[model samples]
Target: MGALARHWTRIAVTLIPLLIALLHASGALPLAALDRLDNVLYDARLRATMPRTMDERIVIVDIDEKSLAEVGRWPWGRNRMAELTDELFDRQQVALAGFDVVFAEPDDSSGLKRLRALAQGELKDAPGFAGRIDQLAGSLDYDAVFARSLQKKPAVLGYYFSSDRGGGTSGVLTEPVMKREDLRGRPIRFTAWNGYGSNIEPIAKAAPMAGFFNPIIDVDGVVRAVPLLAEYGDQYYESLSLAMFRMLVGLPTVEPGFPRDRFLGRGYQGLESVVLRLGQKTMGIPVDDRVSALVPFRGPGGVSGGSFRYVSAGDLVARRLPPGSLKGKIVLVGTTAPGLQDLRSTPMSETYPGVETHANMISGLLDNRLAVRPDYAIGYDVVVLLLAGLVLAFALPLLTAPKAVAVSLGVLAAVVGLNLWLFLGAGLVMPLAAALSMVLTAFALNMSYGYFIESRSKRELANLFGTYVPPELVDEMVKDPDSYSMTATNKELTVMFCDMRGFTKMSEKMEPVQLQELLNAVFNRLTDIIRDNRGTIDKYMGDCVMAFWGAPVETSEHAHLAVKSSMEMADAVRKINEEHREKGLPEIGVGIGLNTGMMCVGDMGSQVRRSYTVIGDAVNLGSRLEGLSKAYGVDIVVSESTRQLAKDFAWQELDRVRVKGKEQAVAIFWPVAPADRLEKPQQDELKTWAALLKAYRAQDWDNCEVLLLNLQRMNPKKFLYELYNERVASMKLLPFDPAWDGATNFETK
Candidate 1:
């Protein structure tokens, strides 16, 4: 229960954005940016899924520049419009035609009205003028001529819905697709308009069907959908595309398609689709909440696109079209000329002919392949968001950073892939913007916590072990803090002790501050050398310093590091002396001792103050070795155990002596140059010295003396050889014992 509670808490923190996105999807809260992003995704889906090939069933009768030139510009006389219509049906045998333009006023370009007035006034008495004018009146009435051509023809007239402009209704509107009485008891909201522009009364009466061509332009001015049904004064009207499709299928009646749950519950009254019913055949046309159907573009764009064939309007009017060219096809009359301003921004094209939009919609409806955002879209988004968020929130805390990143990436890919699959396979327009945003946002939040909080944890661990471990080892310790600590543990390690020689006498001669400064300078240089070789400083006891390795973090080369630090420390003292000599101060020297063995290492001391240090017999022997360095006339002396571990360094046997406090004998060696850099003379000298030790250990006094004399002559300044010679002389005075061994026992520390 506690784990679940903790998981829930973390999930809640990261799920804040998911909650907001859910609310936005549910319409409880609206986000403009998300809405715009959804539109962009919708556009991309349309472009990706479009057929991008010529439909060949629908053709555009375009009023191009060539058409305008041949027909003498736009607003051509109605007599010319009659000729175009007559030529299409009579000569081209087009099955159906729809206009993307409207004529709101009568065309009197034939001068018939003026001639009638002249007949009634000035030309009333002209010879045979009244009779001739009456005879030609019928032919001169261009509005009547156009209306006669459209009478009883399978032609749908187009119009526009005017909104935000007050009190402007032009021409005459056709019979509404559905009357207010048709849906008297049903609850439905249609897109309403204040006024409209329609064809003149004569044209409206003569056309077989009429529908508006006004599209539902989004806030970004991109036409993504068209209202299949619009309302004016509680009367629903059909769109041009919807009207053409209905006429094709024997004029099916339009009805609202609302979804219900449990057959009895009016759970959601929102419109889901627009249904067309002809006898028993039913077709459901998907619509959005606003009763608009998504525009199904067949290709890339309207004009340049190859979705529909375009024929110049002037060709039709001039009878230049081949017989049956538009036969058995749906013809839409529109213009692509830039001056006509029929171009619109659509999902498929920025500058598209308005007529092609209707063609695409008609094709989509006939094929029933329109992409629909189902009513359960919001529910799906919420479910996906919560599932992804919960999984990330719970799993991120338990896994390491790398594993958490892997899981997040997997979830992200699954989410995106599923969305695209639904879009392509099911023709379902699901909401991806919210789901994708939630996934990325949650992953970012999880990773940010690890980066910031773990960084602070690394700092804390560094502070805890910084003084007792190298910086590099401290970093390793922080990587797994639970397994590392300051508690004492017994482990085989190497410890080193270094002290300045003659420091007491030097301090007695100098002032207190001067002595302190000199000690600080010497200790700083020595400590830097120790750290450089991966040694940890244990403490600074006045002029002496203690350090160790293979603690807090394990290393296999602890002895090697200690010996290396010791050698570097000896060389560093020489550099310090050079600096002191340049400054007219007394030069200083140091003695270093290294020993390797099992020891208890960790924080040790009183409660008032404690320190991370080592304690055991090995640690005591290391101190004894440092004190023995002076007696051997050398800078560094290491125990046999340390010497065995550090085989890469050159060594010279110092003595076989047991320091005070212990009776067991142990061998000590002085570290020389690195083995790789040792000179041949030094190698030869070591070989001769080894033979001398063997002779001395065997009680052969004469051979030992002779070997020592030769070594002294070869390396005259070697005080260690003189000490061994003195030992040989002292042993010669004592009577030889058969059980005696060459082990010198020191009685002082």
Candidate 2:
């Protein structure tokens, strides 16, 4: 065992790097997948434990449906927006007001004609397109009113960056927040164009300090991080959220740190921190000098009501709101109507309000509640990955299968738990994906190579049983053949038996050589179907095949798989018949029966002719069911035990019968195709049949008979209807047993 362990260890060590490389190359094991998994786990954890809202301060001004209906249509006149701004600064006494909506054009609702007429006075009455001229003049003058509102308070105008060439159509931007000279010899690159802002002259002049509100959404469209500053041409611009945060904290001038000489070359110092110099005190603001910050979203939908403070423009204009509500809050004016295109898709909500995101960010900054990935995070990830790989490589090879699995799972859980703890407790966002990758790589390498190393043993077992059992089962048995050595032990297992209907007459007409080829092909197809469903083929006798589940390997879904495979096999025979007809060969049909019960399974038969098979009353019933298939004129028959495991498929209870040698009656069902595939009438008929079965099982003879009659009228070929008819006839002649269970028992094997 020690020698074996050492060999396994050596293989594990050699395979880890290769597995990592393969997973990376295939793109199957993506960092993004881990990120998604992390998000899912986090969401579930949040749901279960109800993560307390961290100290992060976030407030929402919701532009909800109520606000939209009352405020009129979206893109309300700029004059009304200006009023909202005035209320925030004067009434709410908000530290800063940031516009998530852009004001690229003047608000024409203030009566451009009136402004022009006022400016021109007597000339406004002049003839010849005077109204048109007044309109243009009024529009130009209204720009000034909007700008004046912005000047009354510190406000950050939100704008977006466009990667498209057409972005230039939006016009030029204001002076940048950062200059090219400031970056020096950094490796930063910029290729986006600034676009789509309400650039009305009045608004621009009023709010000189603004930020781009373009969030850096990942490919999955989740906003996890925000760029603090971005370079456009030779200038750097701050994000709107960041700018608002800066203003709220008091607009302190920032001084660039001096350059420092490093081993690689001359590098700039203080790239990760900016000094905010205020009056007599200076505070260091931690940032990734490259101008990005990790956004600490407050759970899903952001701190419960953080989506917005929904208020209608109509309500404000009507003075319906209570006093002091908007007196001191930084209110954002934006839309939540889906048609407005201001909504964003998020894991938490399909129609996420975009403007509220800025509120959350600003609120978070003010509360000094921020989550960050330290500068050394990438290095930390690399270290974790390497260490995890090494640990798995050393430990997996020395432990048994169960122990190995336990250790792997434990390590995985530990890494994820620790990473989440860091995120929640320490405000640190660690790279969980990289750590998980290490664990996955280790497992894949060990399992992949273990199969290769154990091929000789597997092949020997396969050679011994492949002729009888399915190839998949043979491989499973080879994993630990000794444990499955011939024995008689009771264990719940699903058994299936399939036999060709009317084979004797069909075979007599065909040549011996053709018959052999046809039977081989049919059985081969059946074997493939069973293996595909993870069922173990027990043996084949002449035209009959026997397979079982929960032996050689154990699974909770064995009964489900057995029944599903039975249905699939029946479908396979139909397809086979179509091919046989095209090829001018004898057509064949199949009957399948599945039973789930405690049975003795092991390698049975003499040592000279050993074979693995199961035996018990359960196995006998399965064979009896195969014969009953012909009697009922149905392709597949399943006992109650099998039906219990079928969670997905629909079925019809065919009968309650005591076949040949069984004392107790059994309930049998025929698995039906999906409801979508069945015609409307067929679906109705099946419903009726099910109702009849229920009534019959309850000994409600009159209702059962009525339902069965309706079922027969709807679909005459339904075997279940005929079976119920027989049962109803017998109930009239003999007194029913009150203790009679709905169980169907088969007396023939």
Candidate 3:
């Protein structure tokens, strides 16, 4: 039952994140903010790479506010537009002239107004004369002059299509670039016009080709792509850009290639490329059939004041141009001023010229430098999301928390990098935001479940073992219960034993209550310092505190931590001494000793009374070193192993001595501040002390005494010199053991 419960808990921890990630990827838990962020990133990238100049073939005749103020309001009388067209064709030799504005309403002044004026003149003369005049010139084509100008030039008049009832006008659609049969069942809704704005008869007769200039805006209001072909009723139409290109190449008809169902289960189809067979030459235009081609805007400032030459209608009417400047150029007439409201909000710029956008598309079609979003992009995102979820679901169950975190970070980085490579290197825009969200959501959910569900029990276990083991160590044990058990085992760990030097003497002077209070305060402070340094408290023996490292938690720096903790404990004891002195009580001092060697660290007592503590030769040596601190007049003493680990700190060798029990001698040293912090004189004195220790180890009594005497003279407060002085005196009398080792043997534990 316990095993089943554990397995179920693990599964729950894994599955929760997987579900969350999948939901996030599928848009069930939509992240609108993320999508916006993605758009911003893409827009920034596009802006960074915007073309500074338009292709020489394309030109924009901006209907700017300046032009508007110069020529008077919009419907600049079709006759004036017709005059501009005549100048573009006859004077400048323009290859093609395309209008971006739609003339859905005919010029009333040309036709209706002329007829009415003639009728009014006749009515004034006689009642029957009005009827006779109306009969003579029944359809007095008032727009005859405007129609004559339009017929003189080769022009492609612009018109718009509307999905809503109120917007469509009466106009015919041109032939489609691609047939509906190519898209299978994908519905293509095209707009049809029910009315004409210009002289329809003249426009049809003059301009051999006309195309719709309608642009489709997406839900977000950004025009990323334009449809190559649109259908209205039974007729299909080409874009103005497409129609102009066909006219330039003299290709009456062009075809677009669209492939179907080449990606995942989702039925996907779009134009692979457009093929224009012009006379004897064939050109391939790259564009997605479904959406419009991406327009590379030059930027807000555009190519040198928006990078296009602006020739005003007023200038053309006045014949002020340098003459023949518009010859053989594809001319596009559109508004530029913000007040005109023809401005569009794009990812790159908030106030971009809509006509410039068309120019970019047309130029892209001509140059074949186009970007495409593949049909498989959506499928790729879905696959990534599901795979990320599944991986987290299966992997989270078997790994520890730290390992799981490492894996999650690695996976997240890989997904982000892959998306970036696809975009930056291949010009393919893969879904990074969605894929990233999936990985992050999975990681977060799994971590949450682990903490809220599994970690609570682990925390309880930690609390139970807190008195005997460090929390970090207990946590590690909980993660792998099989590897850790409350059994005695020997291992190399650093043990530290600290005790108050004058506790007994101080307690005799203080009242019982005061003594207890002081001892509690002192122990609490010292215990916390020990645990903070990652040392587990073994036991507190009255005034003595014992701790060790490398038991419940394995650490490579256990020796270093032990030495550091001992120094901290000694400093804490000195602080307590100051408080005791302020209260008119006897001051207290502490001695700490650290030793590193093999020791059994686990529950070590009768089953009912078991305590987590260390028991071995090294543990006893640590206690004895603390007791010997008073003899050496030093606050902290560390064995050779501990000294080696504290290489970053300055230290002075004290002595080579054998305690009561063992014959082998041990080397001990006192840790000082870091070497860089030591004064020059102090450093010199330390150097002398080292020389004295070397002499003593070599059993050269006279030289050892000489160096020790010099060191004591230089630094009178240095206890190491004093201790070595005594060692030299004793060694001089008793011939040193020839096989003497720098090992300190503890006589009593």
Strongest candidate by TM-score: 1
Winner on lDDT between 2 and 3 is 3
Query: Clash pairs of candidate 1?
Result: none
Better of 1 and 2 by lDDT: 1
Ranking by TM-score: 1, 3, 2
lDDT (C-alpha) at residue 194 in model 3: 39
lDDT (10s digit) by residue, model 1, range 40-120 = 988887787788888888889999999999889889999999999998898899899999999999898999999999999
Runs in model 2 with CA error above 4 Å?
1-14, 17-72, 91-93, 110-141, 166-175, 189-198, 255-275, 279-290, 302-308, 451-455, 458-749
List TM-score per model, in order.
Answer: 0.73, 0.56, 0.69
Question: Highest lDDT: which candidate?
Answer: 1
Runs of candidate 3 exceeding 4 Å displacement: 1-53, 69-79, 104-145, 162-210, 228-238, 249-314, 367-486, 491-494, 501-521, 528-534, 549-561, 576-587, 594-598, 631-633, 637-749
lDDT of 3 at 92: 81
Candidate 3 TM-score versus the reference: 0.69
Whole-model lDDT, candidate 1? 0.86
lDDT score for residue 259 of model 2: 30
Expressed as tens digits, the lDDT of each residue in 106-211 for candidate 3 is 5675455565676687556655756765664424443444556666465676766665555444644444465556445555333344333332555555554676
